[model samples]
Target chain A: HNGSVFHPGTIVFPAALATAQAIGASGRDLLVAAVAGYEVGIRVGEFLGRSHYKIFHTTGTAGTLAAAAAVGHLLKLNPSQMLHAFGSAGTQSAGLWEFLRDAADSKQLHTAHAASTGLMSAYLAKSGFTGAEHILEGKQGLAAGMSSDSDPSKLIDRLGTRWTIAETSFKYHASCRHTHPAADALLQVMLKQDLKPSDIAKVETLVHQGAIDVLGPVTDPTTVHQSKFSMGTVLAIVAHYQFAGLQEFDQHFHDQDICSFRDRVTMVLDPEVDSAYPQSWIGKVKVYLNNGEVLEGRVDEPKGDPGNTLSRTEITDKAMRLAAFSGGASPSEMSAAIER
Target chain B: HNGSVFHPGTIVFPAALATAQAIGASGRDLLVAAVAGYEVGIRVGEFLGRSHYKIFHTTGTAGTLAAAAAVGHLLKLNPSQMLHAFGSAGTQSAGLWEFLRDAADSKQLHTAHAASTGLMSAYLAKSGFTGAEHILEGKQGLAAGMSSDSDPSKLIDRLGTRWTIAETSFKYHASCRHTHPAADALLQVMLKQDLKPSDIAKVETLVHQGAIDVLGPVTDPTTVHQSKFSMGTVLAIVAHYQFAGLQEFDQHFHDQDICSFRDRVTMVLDPEVDSAYPQSWIGKVKVYLNNGEVLEGRVDEPKGDPGNTLSRTEITDKAMRLAAFSGGASPSEMSAAIER
Candidate 1:
């Protein structure tokens, strides 16, 4: 959720490096271009959309432009030349919608391509090549071609005023957003009822339609990637385990008990719940007891939403946990760096 | 333009650095993530149609997801966490249509944002946060939301077979692609006609519809960025000068003759030529003489296009020229590097 404030250094570094090496741009120019690129990239991207999930992936789409701008700015190109850089990047724009399929590795590649391609575009423009000027607004322009709905004004919207980097969200969980509420809810139910896996007969989950479509109807996930998308699998692990974390997902994805429990769990989809969407990732879980009793609990908002936002302390704690897993830094050091 | 296989290090280095630092990721993991990210990002992006310019900016849109996936992979998060990382990135996705709007700086920003946000998303997910799993395939998924025409299967079309990095283009010019054909055409006309600027009165350019829509309606551009997008500006400089390279773009963007000639040139949009489109970035230029004589030329393909692609020698020559402008390595050394 990038709100505002573009940091060109973010995209510039990558773009400039490639361009510099490509056309033998000086190292000094590369460094300067990198910083400038990030600033321009972030600023422009911020103007487009921060939380518009459906429109485009700002980092990939806009990042290329920023990279090109940084290179153009560094090379001291005229405004028209800069426009060619934009056109070059636009013609080469790309990113995919496959991450949602199974969270494949392509997600990470998007950034690399943008950075590399953008720098290439700038270098080409700098060398007296030409590109489209109306690449974004023409009949087959970026807006008309890439996005269904675009406010052309957004391109120049607050050109230098708002930055997008400021609004970006920092994650504390490694699971799907749709599943966080369920995880939190299950944890709470287990804590309140003090129940063990042995006492539970069947677990029923009611969640937003979006979540159901994404994480429901879990049968059997053979791979680690697929297991994370299975609501049934996630619930199975939570019901039988003390804590649900990265280790649980990685280690028990194919465990027999987890698999068995996943099959026993039933997920119900409700559109009414999905209406709240990103604002409140809501979920409800019912645990049927062997004694003919049903204990129901609902988590209307997950722990990371703005309403249920994680405190600074919570964020740091989570960062520390991840750092520990990566085996690189201590929680305190990670926390300090983030705070700074 | 990047159609051959080259070292991943060249492209991966820059993208990885921006991605890691922007998201507060550790430097140690950046390199590993970058390599892996490049492999995944390129492959996935290529699958989505590397040759098509209509769907989305593959490098920008798909690149973000690739960056996110790389970061997630480096962090070793399960599928659920990776999905969240991608979802976070999806929500923040965007790039401008302004490239077509007089070659705005938005083009460069596209790639920069993708790299930055992808890194950010992964870092967040690593911190034990959540995001949607069906970020791409859901009803409001990336494909459905951003693109009117998308092939979801393209996401994993050839998962591990082909890599996108191998198909990347390394540019040899600093101008717009549309103007490249015109530039070549003008240069050819100059060589053949041996005509001086004093002999030319009016320069009329005929180009494809895409070219006219993008680079036509040329105007006086103040910034170098803007000048690159102006076909008139590019043609004026190339037609008037004996040498055209990076230095001309950098040092002479505001030269009086270039500016004055830019004011005199007119670009006409030809509908009959529009049908050729992406296939042939064709261009025809007519120079009307003060003595009632006419010198006309047409280029069916530009130097960078597949049919008229630049040879290794040409690429090196361009690189050398850029090096001379940057006052760094000689063209020979730069050329060697590119060849290497």
Candidate 2:
């Protein structure tokens, strides 16, 4: 089970549209290809060791290859050509961790590139060109070159039996993944204590090293991208609104009161939490109220983590919500199509 | 001076088209924007140190930022907004050493991504959305995060006094950049001796570390992508046809004799030659003839290197030659537009 904030439909739909159009494939074929792609993409992401973050972005880079494999399968490419397609996909693989630097657009574009390039690689392979046979295991192969260490057998290691798409997390907010646990914990504490922004003297967050490395010290983030990655901003928004979602990404997402409240929130890095991350996306939130009240909440596992899975209905609701913002699709329509 | 291969017209044309369409910018505005983008992209690549087999592909990552800056300048985005656009581009920045793993399609796609993403960031900023401001200089900036080290000052170091496009290398062959020097040397030797492929017993190539890392070993390459990155295949194509270009990348480009001869050629890594690269893109070739004779040729600098630059007429000639193969616009038309 993984804590990725992507729903099956959202991941599969965009990929299906691009794959179908590129190959002149039918809509039904496209849907089947997308479901297959989502399954492989999630599995590859999971098989990659949990600490693989130091090497590559599992979603965009590995996801692209999985998507390519699905397109290859749908196009009915022979085994040899399918391997070539995977090789081509491997060569095209890209998505750097630097995106977390400022909540850059690369985060979104990584998906766009993976979807488009995976489709393109499949089409190119279908045009009768060959690729490497041992792309994944060669001396200078994908795993050898990109990953410091990887198990080649993990690729086909129980592929059809276990599906990765079933294990992914569906995001309820559009913030950095690392910030979700803290945001979830902070929201719970505020809700339980009925805390008001003015009544809070200080809010202290004890989080993993990775969290602070990713979303720490929000000193005047002037842009939506920066605010989205800021713990201070997320906590402030939560304290003020009692929730965090896409609305928090608006241009005027931050107000003076929110900014003032954000200044009072300090994040302390805890090594114990740092060691447990990816395996346990835990967080601890301590709130100091102005009325001399102290409330604390510790989340060993966030709601979206595989440990606490969202129902299909809940996933459909979030997808529809996002689709409404993305335009031209409704939740029920998407759910029906996905169900098929 | 940069050693990267880029056609000014090719780079400028696509960049101009996307930026103009996205911002509703027009004629003269588009032209100025293209020129500005070319200048910035080239300069940024140059400032990132020199291109090598191991370093990140500078063109795509730095080029995206430069293109964004150019678009921002044309659209007249304020300093803060322009910086955010740069930050947005940086976060989205990607391109890896693994692309050279087998000269995959992702190689070309990198350029397309840079062009498209740069335009996308500028368009987003134009529509009044905000992005990170200190994407380059923040505690976790692009330079500090992506590469071993980056000089943010290089971005604005020589804002206007320097011109980068003026120094770019226009490729003479369709293969990987590292293989160019050796291919140039092989062609020189073949042309001088006027020897047929059958007359050659064995071909020995001495090249730099970068070349070896990219295209060493005559071992089999099952696909076109792999062959393009193979020194053996490149030398085979060059020895057989006395040239390698875009036409040779087509489906019917391979010949049995070339493939056979490619197997006969042995490539060795020369530390002496490797040390001279970037500063001097030189390669040495020694051919053992069938009749107990040895023929040798050394190319200190390829034709497209900045020192031995291709003139406007030469560039046009090259474009026209490529256009003929693709049934696209004539070189004259491309040259005319570029001159304008």
Candidate 3:
């Protein structure tokens, strides 16, 4: 929501799976609950507006309400009960961006806490527990406490007609979503010129303000995970390898050659890009070559966006690679789980 | 912290007991952990200031850090790890006043989640997990997201010289702390005048803004828990029974006579009380008798305050009565547990 990006699945899936399994729910029931969670979570995130995203992590704050919606749906709660769940969930909504400055594991804990707390809210509501009915728009509410630019209409806009779950994007590059546009743009310029990393004198990414706000903190990333948030590192990997994947980040993020390339990359705020942001991430980059020639590359939609989505095969391959990298499952095991 | 009143034991004791039992820590260690939790939580709560208290629940927001401090101490974490735990805990600090509007059970969930989440953060930090080192005062931290009137000095005020744990008050009335001053004052007026419930025509309470902010929502409370937040209900019980204890609230809170008395009670804002409030809750009430006689009562310190603490015997009796009321423990079981 707004300019901040986070995976709704991190919170919703846990709540859906837990509630579904506990109640012996059908697969169709689980899927419906998941969709409801995404819709409500996304709407809430959007409602909180830009000011809220500047400081609070939407995934953690809105994720609680999303998780509750999914569980409440699965439980077949009455309207009043569902509202109580929202009240309970909203009261406990919390997450901040401070941890990003330290590359903290707080991101995982935030989603985990949101999922569990939201699930608990649904269960409590089922037991006739009361909660604030006007929690979202009340005098003392989520927006009142957390946002300066909240819009109530964003919550119910296109309500049943629009499905926000379909709008969620896949991560094409193994980096922060803020860096994806620039990474893709850099790769485009490098591919068009048939040039190597050494041929580039400087590369300037014409970016949005949100990108700067989120990615500007990491001047010198020391860890692999932290390096993913550094726009310079992501653009450097893209310029050299064409694909800023997990392997590239893990193996060469801090390579002397990559670091040298990273130093050459800079982010410049562009009015056009800033205006289009959150709604549309417009990628525009200027590549200055050693031969005194400047080339421009632009992409209206970066890869993995709704308009430029990944294929089913690409999704499968990405999932398999991630599973293999973590050693979470073997190839056959992963395939069997996916099939199930 | 600020003008908000919350039970520190609700968040601290659970975390300390859980960690102590999990690690098989000594009784002294557990006690030390609880104290550490109280000191840090109280400091953080005070640091966030009055603006934070208006919308957020102090126990829930500051409780996470307090719980983490206690658990981290028990885990023998290094300074760096302890700092990381604080960061993780701060990122998850959340609770809102919205739920109180509906007499919600969210209060219990808030403390429960704080205890568990804080415990988890400490464990994660112990395992080398990094977190924001400046979560309390960072640009995108707790104060930035939650407070408009935060004072950093409150966090370090007295530091090692004074123990905030010593300042926490016990509840003398089975009602919201916001109503205690008025309840005590009303009881005093009736006692001084040798008046029965039938003799009083009206009771006016001079209260602080914080009390109004917290207690003003319940115009006509319907539940036992909700009635505790109604100044009128508490004062009415006090006028009738000379006490607003658990039994009084449970049995007579909704009685016809009590309801009639409740209608005559009113709360008016007082600048003197407001200025001294949070630091010192002073009670002042005016009782207008049926015969046109007026009696005034005042108390600098209410019962169960640090200046007017309950005796050991009273504390024991209160505990036994509470346990018996909930059927959580028998008298023998309560005595044995207390002895152990």
Best candidate, TM-score-wise? Answer: 3
On the 0 to 100 scale, the lDDT of residue B340 in model 1 is: 68
Model 2 score (lDDT)? 0.66
CAPRI classification of candidate 2: incorrect
The 10-residue segment of model 3 chain B with minimum total lDDT is B1-10
Clashing pairs in 3: none
Q: Model 2 over residues A1-340: C-alpha lDDT tens digits?
A: 3432223343345766766686698767876777677765655554444444453456666666667867786788787677667666655555555545545555666666677667666777888644445555565444543454456566676677866655666565676667777777888887777766788898888887656655654466767777877888878887777666676667345788888877887888877777776557787888888889888888887767666777878777777767877775776777787788
Tell me how each candidate scores on DockQ against the true complex.
Answer: 0.12, 0.18, 0.75
Candidate 1 error regions (>4 Å)? A1-174, A183-204, A209-228, A242-253, A266-269, A285-297, A303-340, B1-174, B184-204, B209-218, B223-226, B247-252, B286-297, B302-340
What's model 2's TM-score?
0.76
The better-scoring model by lDDT among 1 and 2 is: 2
Least lDDT summed over 10 consecutive residues: which range in candidate 2 chain B? B1-10
Per-prediction share of native contacts kept? 0.21, 0.11, 0.89
Tell me how far the alpha carbon of residue A200 in candidate 3 is from the true structure, in angstroms, after superposition. 2.2
Ranking by TM-score: 3, 2, 1
Q: Per-candidate TM-score, first chain only?
A: 0.64, 0.82, 0.96
Per-candidate TM-scores read 0.55, 0.76, 0.95
Predicted candidate 3 versus true structure: per-residue lDDT over B1-340, tens digit per residue: 2233556789999999989999999999999999999888988888887788888888999999999999999999999999999998999898888777778787787898789888888998999887899999998899999999888888888899988888888888888888888888888877777889999899999999878887888888888988988988998888878878889899988999988888898999999898897889999999998999988989888988988888998899899999999999999999999898
- In DockQ, how does model 3 score against the reference complex? 0.75
